[model samples]
Target: MNLGIVGQAVGLFAVTNIDDVVVLALFFAQGAGRRHAARNITVGQYVGFAAIVAVAVTAAFGATFLPERVVPYLGLLPLAIGVRAAVRVWRHRGRGGQEEDERTGPGGPRLLEVAAVTFANGGDNIGVYVPVFATAGIVGMSSYVVVFLALLALWIAAGRYFATRPVVARALSRWGHLLLPMVLIGIGVVILVDGGAFGL
Candidate 1:
C-alpha cells in the first residue's frame, strides 16, 4: 500500500462522508435506549456503504450502473422517509408519550431503513468514488477500500460519542423525532437541488 494512496483515500473518504457523522448522530439519538439500535445503525451503514462502493467499483471497471441524471431520483428515498416520519408525528400529536414511543418503538430503527437512508445520502459519495477508484489500479483500490472501511468505523464512533454526550443526548431525546424528519427532508432537498433534479 503506497502511503500516498492511503493518504489520498483517507482525504477523499473524509470529505465525502463528513455529513454522515451528523446523520448518524441523529440516528443514534433517536435509537438511544432501544434494543439493538446501535447495532442496527452500524450494520446498516456498512451495508449501505458497501453497496455504494460496489457500484463505484463496477462503474470504474467500465460498467455504468447509474446515469448522472438518475442520481437525483435517489433523493426521493429520503424525502419519502421524512414525509412518513412527519406524518407519523403529526398523527400522534397530543398522544402523550405515544409519539416518542412510536418513534423509538420496539424494533428500534430498522436495519434496512437505516441502510436506505445511508445509501440515499451517499449519491455524492458514489460520484466521487467512481472517478477515484477508476484511476486507482488494483493495488491502489485495495488500499482505498481498506482505508475507507477503517474510517467508517471511526465515523461510527464519532457519531456515537456525539449522541451520548449528555447535553446533546438530552436535546436529541427531547426533539429528535421532530428534528430527524426535518433533517431528512432537508438532505433530500439539497440532493435534489445539487444534482439539478427537476431543474432545481
Candidate 2:
C-alpha cells in the first residue's frame, strides 16, 4: 500500500510541473538573505498542497461533493499556469539579475511575500490534485504527503547548493524558463487523458 501510494504521488508530482523548483532554485542561488524566505515558501507550498489534498480527499470519500465536470476544467489549469510562468520568464530574460536582486534584498526574507509567491506557484499542483484524488481516493494520502515533503526538502537542499555555483546557475537559468511551460503542458495533457477527455 505504501509503495502504491508513493508511486502515485511521484507520478502526480512529476506530472504537475517543475517550474516551481527552477524558480525556487534561482531564488536561493541569488542571495543569502533569502534562505529563510525560501523556507517560508516551502512551508506555504506544503500548507497549500495539504489543504488541496484534504479537500480532494473529502470529495473522493463523498464527504463533500464536487461537480463531475470539475476534473476536465482542472486539466486546463496547469496549462494556464505554465503559460503564465513562461511569460514571466520571457519578461525577465534581460532583467533577470535586477529581478533577483529585488526579490532577495539585504533585509531578511519576507515571510508573507514568500508565502504568497509560493501559493501562486503551487496553483498547477492544486488542479492536478483534484482529479488525482477524485479517482485514486485517499488511500495514499499519508504516503503522498511523506513523499512530497521529502522532495521539498531535496529541492531546498539543491537550491542552497546551486546558489553558490554561479556558472552552473547561469547555465541552468538560460533554458530553465523555456522548460516550465512545456512541463505544465505535458502534465495537463496527461491529466486530461486520464480523465477520459481524449477517449483514453
What lDDT score belongs to each candidate, Candidate 1 first? 0.87, 0.58
True-structure lDDT of candidate 1: 0.87
Most accurate candidate by lDDT: 1
TM, every model: 0.94, 0.54
lDDT of 2 by residue, 45-97 (tens): 56655555565567555665545555444556566666766786678778867
Worst 10 residues of 2 by lDDT: 107-116
Q: Which one is best on TM-score?
A: 1
- lDDT for predicted candidate 2 compared with the true structure: 0.58
Give Cα distance to truth, residue 194, candidate 1, Å. Answer: 1.3
Candidate 1 stretches with Cα past 4 Å from truth are 98-105
Displacement of the residue 11 alpha carbon in candidate 1, Å: 0.9
